[model samples]
Target: MAEGDGVVKSAGRVLGLLQVFAEHRRPMRVSEIAQAMGIPQSSTSMLLKTLTAMGYVSFDAEAKAFRPTLRVALLGAWLNEEFATEGSVDEMMVEMARATADAVILAVENGVWSEYIHVVQSEQDLRYALRPGTKRPLPATNLGRVLLAAKPDDEIERIVRRINAEAAAGDRRFDVATTLDAVHAIRRDGYSFAHNLISSGASVIALPMPVPPGYKPMAIGIGGPTDRLERGQEMILAEMRRLLSQYLGG
Candidate 1:
């Protein structure tokens, strides 16, 4: 591999290592992390040592494990602040939850995946329950399609092809043509809605949120059972627009 390409690959691995900690939410032994990530033990040890020196990970000498430091949480704090007038994403989530009366979430594109950064559960008994930091392919739901619709067609096609190939390898069924059609619809309508796409009897409606000029695009969405969400689709979309306009000045 070329030197530059190698550097990029290494950087991605480092980020992936950090994400493992975020997802697992616990300290892990070097061998455990290596096994989980399929990285060689020696290489994982060296990487952890470097990360420790950089203050991004902390070593627990007593437990012989490593965990992510507060520094990792602070990394994305500024990006969240950029979207809020008072710099509190929680405030926005709270408002969206109250207005939508369903699960409200904030998500962004992570490669060809949609990563939920924040979530507020619905008060209703029959609502979709999605945890924060959940990552899924962009074509799986409207929460992802809203962000993907903003990308150029060529880039969208590439992401779709890669996602489908991965799905095929896993023996999962995915329709690329249908996903492309949904992308085009999202592009035209400036929002997206999906019913029973991510889970049985669940539905989602999402729209892109306005951010500062150079910030990566992020979306706010609401999810609930298909019967309730489909019944209230118009009202939910209207409330989402109003919420975005009120707080974000979009």
Candidate 2:
């Protein structure tokens, strides 16, 4: 094979090693990665050591296994989105925060959950306690559901099945069929609103917002007590649509 071909093959091996750490957050030994990825143990050990040298993996002395470092899994995405959107999303999120006065958040789908990237505080004493890296289930929050609604049917089915399996394993609370129906409803509705559905006396409305090409998508949310954003739903969505258009257009 050519030099370029060899480089691509090496990259594929490195990425495969990276994926072996993604099934869960725990570390795995070289023998485990070899079996999981169908690569040879000799190659897996060498590749893992290479990744460790690159600051992407660590051989945990206590666990006696290779684990991905925060730096290793960091972009773990297709590519960086910051450069793609040119930073206009920050302004749009702030605009939503100012317009609603309820908590306006920017989030993205992380597995079957939504991860907050930014959050604007609500004036009400009651607020959802979520940090930037916090992960909330798709069925529990409007933000997570809107993202699930945007996914293709097959992807949606897979997520639903995983939810059910987790529920059966006693890790979650809802069935797959009900969750799939909810995702479909959110897609048809274009936005979703629910009050006290997941938490008592807490209300949240979220709409999936578009982003520029080459950028990962986001959602805008207005959350507070049931009465707070109820009156402003239509207005908030309309403003979100406008801001999305402006950022993606120019």
Candidate 3:
């Protein structure tokens, strides 16, 4: 393999390892981390040892578990002042989740996919478990469509075509014209909503978040069962709008 390819692969594994800790929010054994990352235990142990030596991760001998150190949290803490303040995106997501009793997700465009960077699980018993690091095709999800709405038509079409070109035969393919129409609707309406488009009996309502300069485009979404989301659409939209205006001033 090329040296650059190896570097990128290693970087992705480090980020994925950090994300596993973020998802579980607890110290994890080597076996647990390996299983979560779908990597070999030996590799996981080596990675953990490297991180420990770098002072980015800590290992507890008594518990035989590893956890990210404060240095890891400090790495990106200065990137966004808003994130360090009271009226943060994190706070808004929590409020939205509480108000709607549904899953709230913060997604960012990652290559041709929309990746959920943060997810507040629904309080409702019947809801699905949407975890952080979940990814979906950029042109095929409401959350993704809202992120795409921030881009120009030409870029959207290019991205759609690329997604189609790379997709396997059995995988879903996107129609450029159809995707453009959907993105246009999202732009006109200032939000996107879809029911049962990606998952059966599931609905998602999403709006583009105000991205800071030099930051990737992002969208915040609320998701739940179709019937419940449909019934509470108005209320949910109102809450979302209020929170966005209050916290993000958008």
Candidate 4:
């Protein structure tokens, strides 16, 4: 591999190792992490050592395992604090999560992708939930459409091309015409609703949020099982629209 490709691949491996630890939420032996993440034991050991030096991972000599340190949690603390300081979104997410009994998300555009910055999980046994920092292509998803609603048609199409190009890196392709049509509809309605777009058996309702200065465009979404979200679509959209209107002044 070329130098650049090697760097990127190494970075991905490091992230995947972190995910393994995060998912299990426990200290794990190097061999266990290597097996779970499909990484070579030698590479895993070196990466773990680097992370340990950075204070993002800790080693337990007696247990012969590794775990994420508190520094890992501290990484995003400042940004999360900013979100809470926004005043309404934190409190509003609580109410919305209760009202819909589904996952409530605060999402924003990051380059050609849409990312969930905060997620409030549903109380129900069956619900759709995504960890904060999860990212997806900026088309086809309700949250992505809502976040890009303010752009002109031409600009939206350009962004769609960029998003599709990015997805192409993973052998994924999106229909340009269909995606543009979705963007037009979202622009017309000032909101978006999609079924089985983000995930199988899941539906989402997303609307633009009133973002403060210096912040990127943002949206709020509610997601749940397809049937439940469909049945409560009217109520969910009404409540979210009302909340946005309060902050955005219609």
Give one digit per residue, the lDDT tens place, for model 1 in 229-250.
Answer: 8888899988888777767777
- Cα lDDT, all candidates: 0.81, 0.69, 0.87, 0.78
| TM-score of every candidate | 0.67, 0.59, 0.83, 0.66
Q: What ordering of candidates by TM-score runs from best to worst? A: 3, 1, 4, 2
Candidate 3 local lDDT, 1-250, one digit each (tens): 1114346877878988998887777999999999988888999999999999999999999999999999998787665464423456766888989998999999999999999898888867899578787789998899999999988999999999999999998999999999999999988889998778888999799988876678899999999998988899999999998888777777
lDDT of 4 by residue, 84-195 (tens): 4443455678778887789898888988789887787887999896876688877868998887777787887888777666664555667778887887888777778878
Residue pairs clashing in model 1 are none
Cα RMSD for predicted model 3: 3.4
RMSD of 1: 6.5
* Candidate with best lDDT: 3
Error (Å) of candidate 2 at residue 71 is: 19
- TM-score of model number 2: 0.59
**Which numbered prediction scores highest in TM-score against the true structure?**
3
lDDT of 2 by residue, 1-250 (tens): 1114346878777765654564333788778888877878998888888878988788888878988887953563333253224334555666766766767777887777787766666655666644454577776778887887777867877877776676644566756677678778887888878677666776778887765456565676777777656777677777767666665442
Model 3, residue 120: C-alpha shift (Å): 3.0
TM-score of 4: 0.66
Please list the residue runs of candidate 2 whose C-alpha ends up more than 4 Å from where it truly belongs after superposition.
1-87, 124-129, 167-170, 213-217
